[model samples]
Target: MKMNNYYLELFEGRKNIIILPHILPDGDTIGSSIALFYALKKLEKRVYIILNDKLPSNLKFLNANSKIITTEDFEKLSIKPDLIITVDSSDTDRLGDRAYLLDLCSEVLNIDHHSTNTNYGKYNLVNSKAAACGEIIYELLKKLKIYIDKNIATALYVALSTDTGSFKYSNTTPLTLRIAADLIEKGIDFSFINTELYQNKPINKIKLLSDVLNSLELHFDGKLAVIYVTNDMLKKNKIDISDTDGIIEYARDIEGVNIAVLLKEFSDNTIKVSLRSKYDFDVSIIAKKFGGGGHKKAAGCTIYDTIDNAKNILLNTFRENFR
Candidate 1:
């Protein structure tokens, strides 16, 4: 959907703006937020990027000189935002504790590409057809007549590339590539981004991956694959939960597997479940059933049960719905 002219008008006299990314900061959220930050800076708007979690180690390169603050930092500041803009977040729930900002700010502009978005903003520009939120931001910047310099281009490139799985995911479209090509033309280093995003894995991450692979299990005659990552595995390998980002892809890539599940044990009973589908399956359906939501092929939810119980619940759900 095209952005309403009224939404653009929100920025007309707005001076203090806060950009909120999802709870667990990902490349798409971070990249889109930073790109907007640079663009708003050029407009002489005082903008702040506040994140609920720390930036993943691999994505720190994108925030080299950017001033991204934490929730604690925001709490200490006396500034009340004139407008709140959320990027790549489906709903206020995805904002974690920062959701209260929606009530505090009278004006909100929610920009996202998730089909399951709740339209929780005062002015929402939700386009499920867009491959990434970066695409929406790029269009918004163009409409505002903002210049896309190398910094903004690099940020947007990372946003589009990561959400599209380096342009290999099924979501990639002609417009996606066209925007990416434009960003590349701005002199962004695509090769360096590829290296940092895909190739620069730390030793601990490698060890964690090896350990997680040993827990992989196949069900439904290899049509479905499941992997487990417990707190013990993370402690043993000295890796953070963020390191498990791309591990589920390994399970999804299995030859006969149509669906892949990653059950991460955050505690004794809190299991974070990530689901990925390779074909026509819509994993977001299952995620929404469990109070979470995402894209058709990729989604996640937290199950308040033991690892074994969570796996059984997912397996039963799949059998009831998919079998």
Candidate 2:
């Protein structure tokens, strides 16, 4: 559906705008936010991209102009936004503590591609058919007649590439690649972005990966593959939670593995679960069961329980749900 003209008018009328992304911002969230930031700035709009967490070290390259508002910066701000545009978040709760700030804004616009999006916005432009939220944002910018500069192109490319696993995942479509090709024509150093985000792994990340792989276990006749990362493991390796980013892919790629799970303990006995399916299986269903959501092949949720408890629950769910 076309974005409502009321939202377009709001965008053209609003003076102070804020672009919000989900907490623990990933590549897609950060990239889409930054791309919009540039697009709005081109129109001389007062805009800020506020995120609840710091950018991951790998994705910091996408911040072409060093413009990103962290929770620390946002807390001290005196300016109330006229408009709030949330990108890449499936639901308002995904905004984390920043969700409350919506009350201060006159309008809320949610732009996402998640199938589970709740449309929690005064005006929402959600396209579940899009491979990533970046695709939706790209279309929005085109409708607004914003020029896609090198920086914007690079950011959108990062957004599209990361969410689609550098165009290797099942979610990638012909249109996805075509948009990427157009972005490349804008003179983005695609090779550098790819290498920096994917190939250049830190030593701490390697240590974390080793420990995680060592903890790997295959269950239910090798169909359910699981790996656990404890706070102690992260502390011992001197690595942050971001280091565990893509380690679940290793477990899921194992031969004969149907569903792969990565369980990591955060603080206060809270465990985060990442799920991946190798075939036609729907991991998002399991994620939604745990009060979280994502695409069919990859999804995640957080469980406020012990590691063992979370694992047992997931195992039970898999046994009962898997066909």
Candidate 3:
């Protein structure tokens, strides 16, 4: 879909802009923000990429120049932003504490690919069918007649490749592949990126995964698999929370398991739940029920309860809905 000309006009008029990515800082959000930062820089616009969380270790390579700033740093800056653009976020709540930026800036542009996006921005560009927000940004850049250089292509490639699980996930489409091909043509070292993303696992992360796998349990006649990660597990292994990325997939990939869940104890009363499913089941529906949202096969929600209580709540939710 072509980007609306009004958005282009907003960009042309807005000189001081802030780019906000969703909390937890996934590849798609980081990549789309970086790609847009470079594109806007070429236009001579003062662009700032403000993030609520630190970039994951594997994704740090994409921010080698340190263009992305922490919220604390943004607070120190006196420059008033003319516009704020949120990328890969479904709703304002996904911005965490930074959601205040929406109220501060009169001109807000929200770009995202999630089907559950709330269209919260004054100007929203949401395409639920797009494989990733990177695809939409790529199209938007083309529509704006912006030149996509190697840096921009590399960022967009990271967004496309990671969100689609390196094109292994069901969300991968022909256009996704074609865009990847175009990115490769721009001279991105995809091999290095793949190695950094998948092959280069820290020992602490591997140890944490071992502990997490040992907590795995099967339910619903082996159709559901569940795993747990406690703060103790993370502290024992000296692992960061971000190191737990992709660990839930181990449960989801098991044979006969239609649904996989990862219940993470973020705090004494906060359980961060990650849900993945196979076949026709829509996990996003379940996530939305809990005030979170994501794609059909993958989704997440935060339960304000003990780990055991969260598990029971999820099990009951599944029994009530899927049965």
Cα lDDT, all candidates: 0.89, 0.87, 0.89
Winner on lDDT (2 vs 3)? 3
* Tens digits of lDDT, candidate 1, 145-234: 899999999999989998999999999999999999999999999999989999998899899889889999999989999999999999
- C-alpha TM-score for every candidate: 0.97, 0.96, 0.97
lDDT of 1 at 81: 92
Candidate 2 regions off by >4 Å?
Answer: 4-6
Q: Which ten residues in a row have the lowest lDDT in candidate 1?
A: 63-72
Write one digit per residue (lDDT tens) for candidate 3, span 194-259: 888888888888889899999999999889999999999989998778667788999999999999
Query: Candidate 2 lDDT, tens digit per residue, 218-261?
Result: 99889989999999898998988866778899999999998999
Q: List the residue pairs that clash in candidate 1.
A: none
Distance from true location, Cα of 61 in model 3, Å: 1.4
Give me the displacement of residue 91 in model 3, in angstroms. Answer: 0.9
Question: Per model, how many backbone clashes are there?
Answer: 0, 0, 0
For candidate 3, the lDDT comes to 0.89
